[model samples]
Target chain A: GIQVEQSPPDLILQEGANSTLRCNFSDSVNNLQWFHQNPWGQLINLFYIPSGTKQNGRLSATTVATERYSLLYISSSQTTDSGVYFCAVGSNYQLIWGAGTKLIIKP
Target chain B: SAVISQKPSRDICQRGTSLTIQCQVDSQVTMMFWYRQQPGQSLTLIATANQGSEATYESGFVIDKFPISRPNLTFSTLTVSNMSPEDSSIYLCSVVPGTGAYEQYFGPGTRLTVT
Candidate 1:
């Protein structure tokens, strides 16, 4: 089993502000994913970056396998981005999840 | 990548009763997993449902309490038997399609409350 830790347990930002969330794993992972759990409790996949970097619109993620860490960036955030962001890492048979960073965007 | 659905999006049940949650995936998948997320907590793996055989349970989770069935590649069911108030949580189903793709797609979870 691997240990996954997410930073900044809670964050608050203005609608147009930006923020970064980080996740650290204790072991190497074959799969790493960033998810956004919306206010309605729907888990949306933001990125599937096992390594390197990827960007989708206003969101981007970077996973450094060698360092056993990953970072997620949300640029020009909006009220729609107010939710919980989760980082999960998969090893041999199971996926380890972080405690998630709850974000609040004030309009 | 895959459209996943769960029946009975939310339910409230009495203690000592059993509830079965169904998971359906649009595409064929090789691995299906069941996870539990408590309030203000992270997700924990309950078990891995094998297509034709018994499920592989994780530590701290037992088959008798959280029985799982994987009849085929595209569907599975998880039953919480003899549940108590402590069993109240959101149950989610996830699937990893084919080989080489390690990313898992999650179904909109079933929110259960035991009274």
Candidate 2:
């Protein structure tokens, strides 16, 4: 089983501020995904980036497999972006999830 | 990506009773998984449901307690038997559209509260 670690267990920022969340995995992974759990406890898929960089709206993610690390950037954050962000990695089929980063964007 | 719908979005059950959560996918999926999330905790894989076969349960979970049925590729059910307060958690159903990757899309979880 692979171990996943996320940095900054808790984060707080102003509505227009920027932040970066990092995830590190102990072993090589074939699949990697970022998920945002909203206030209502709904899990929303943010990105499915096994490698390379991807951007969606004001949020972007980059996964460096060689470094066994992934970074999620939030720029000009909005209040709606407040929630728990989870990064998961899997090798064959089973996925190992990080504890998640709790982000709070003050309005 | 496939859209997944779950029945009984929330429920409060009594001890010794069982609750069956149903998961329906808009499209056929190659794999379906059941995960449990405790309050303020991360998701834990309970089992993997395969069509026309018995589900494969993860360590610490048993089929007798969390029975699963995957009659088809688009639908599955997970039943929590002899419920207790400890069984209260969010149960989520997820699926991978096709093979080659393990990226999964999750359903709006069923929030259960057992007394």
Candidate 3:
């Protein structure tokens, strides 16, 4: 089984501030996804990046497969961007999830 | 991406009672899974909903307690039996569209509260 660990277990920043969350996995994986669990408990897929970088709006993610790590960046954050961010990685089928990074944006 | 929906968005159950959750996908997917998210905790894989046969559950999860049924490719159900307060959490279902796409999409989740 692979271990997925996320950094900054808890984060608090003012609105408009930027933050970066990291996910480190113990083994190589073929699938890696970043998800945002909103306050309403809806899990939204942010990115499906097994490797390389991708950007969507003010949020972007980069995964270094060789290094077994992924990074999620939130720039000029807004109040609505407060929630838990989780990273799930899987090799063939089963996925292991991280504890998640709880981000709070204060207005 | 597929539109996943869960029935009985939220429910309150008494101890010793059981709750069955329904997950429906708009499209046929190759894989369906059940996950549990404890209060203020991360997600944990419960089991993989196999379309035809018994489900493959993860360690710490058992078939007797969390029975799963995938009657077809687009629908599945997870039943939490003999529930207790500890079973109070959000249960979510996810799917892999397959067809060469491996990205997983999640359902809205069912929030259960046990007394």
Candidate 4:
């Protein structure tokens, strides 16, 4: 099994501010994805970056597979971005998840 | 991407009762997975449901406690047997379509609260 670790266990920022979350893996992975679990409990797929970088709206992510690390950036954050961000990795058939970074955006 | 629909989006059940969550995928898939996310916790893999065969449970999950069934390629069900308050969490179903690649699409999820 692979180990996933997320940094900045907790983060609080103003609604208009920006922040970055990092995820580190213990072993090589064939697949990697970033997910945002909203307050309503729906896990929204943020990025499917096994390597390289990707952007969508105000959110973006970069995965350095060789370094075994990935980063998620939220620019001009909104109150709706408040929730837990998880980094999941797949090796064989199963995916291993990180504890996640809890983000709180204040108005 | 595959579209998945899960039944009983949310439920509150007695501690002794059981709840079965159904996952339906718009596209046929050979592999389906069940996951549990405790409050404020990371998602944990419950088991891997393979069509025409029994599911393979994770380390902490057992078939007797969380029975899973995959009768076909596009649907599966996971039953939380003899539920407890600790079982209160979001149960999500995910599937991987095609071969060679391993991208997964998840369903909305079922929120369960046992008291």
Candidate 5:
């Protein structure tokens, strides 16, 4: 089984600030995904970047497969972004998950 | 992207009872998984449900405790048997819709509390 680790266990930002979250994996993965679990406990898909970079709205993610690491960027953060962010990697039908970074955005 | 749904969004039960959570996917899928997430904790895979055969249980899970059934490609059920206070957690179902993308979609999850 692979190991997934997320940095910055907790973060706090102003309503319009920006922040970055990092995820490191111990082994190569065939699939990598970023998810946002909002206040209502819904797991929203942020990105499915196994490699390269992708952007959606005020959020973007980059996965360096060769380096076994991924980064997620939240720009101009809003109060709505106050939740937990998760990184999961999958290989051979098994998905390994990071503990997650809990974010708080003060309005 | 696939639409996934779970039944009984939340429930409270007695310690010795059992609860069955249902997962339904709008589209056909090749792989379905069951996961448990404790309060304020990360998700842990319980088992991988195969369509016609027995499920593959993870290290800490056993079939007698958390039995799973995938009768077809679009639906599955996970039963929390002989529930205890330690079994209180959110149960979620996920699917990988073999579209060559390797992306997994999750259901909203069933929040269970054992008294």
Candidate 6:
């Protein structure tokens, strides 16, 4: 069985602050994804970085497969960014999910 | 880059009742995945339904309780049978559009509550 764990189970920050979330997996993975679940419960796929780094606007992610961990950085955060961020990894069709980091950005 | 739609966005069901959820993809795909997200919890893989073949479910998930049907390339259905209070969760379907490459696009999801 594969294990995926996210760091900082919960976080609260003022708007415009920067934060980092981490995901660690117990095994090698060929597929890794970062998702944001909004207040309305919509799973927004942020990145599919099994390795390397990618940037999308104020959000950026880096996954080091050899280290078996991934990092998600949110810069100049906004209130709309408030939600639960999840990291899931898989070597097959099944994706093992992490408990997620619940982030709240206050204005 | 695909449009996905699910029927009956939300529903309330009585114990012992079964609900069937339909997932439709705008583009054709080889496989569709079903997942469950309980209240205040992360996503859990339920099963992977491949067209023209029986679905392969994850551990702790049985075919009898969670039946999946992949009738075609773009359409799939997941039935939660013999439901109970624990069956109350958000059920979602996802697909790897086009060449797939392990990038999944998920549907809006069906919110089910069993009382």
Error of 5 at A84 (Å): 0.5
For model 1, the stretches where C-alpha displacement exceeds 4 angstroms are none
RMSD of 4: 1.3
In model 2, the runs with Cα more than 4 Å from the true position are none
What TM-score would every model get versus the actual structure? 0.97, 0.98, 0.98, 0.95, 0.97, 0.96
lDDT of 5 by residue, A1-107 (tens): 68999989999999999999999999989889999999888898899898999999999999999999999999999999999999999886577999999999999
Query: lDDT score, residue A17, model 6?
Result: 100
Top candidate on DockQ is 3
Model 3: per-residue Cα lDDT at residue A14 = 99
Predicted structure 4: lDDT:
0.91
Chain A of model 1 scored by TM-score: 0.97
DockQ-based class of model 6: medium
Model 1: per-residue lDDT, tens digit, B40-96? Answer: 888888999999999999899998999899999999999999999999999999988
How do the candidates rank by DockQ, highest first? 3, 2, 5, 1, 6, 4
lDDT of each: 0.93, 0.95, 0.95, 0.91, 0.94, 0.92
Model 1 Cα shift for residue A69 (angstroms): 1.1
* lDDT-based ranking: 2, 3, 5, 1, 6, 4
Per-residue accuracy of model 4 over B3-108 as CA lDDT, tens digit each: 8999999999998898999999998886799999888789999999988888988899999999999999889999999999999999999998877767777899
Q: iRMS of every model, one decimal?
A: 1.3, 0.9, 0.8, 1.3, 1.0, 1.1
Docking class of 2: high
Residue-level lDDT of model 2, residues B10-93, one tens digit each, is: 999999999999999999999999999998999999999989999999999999999999999999999999999999999999
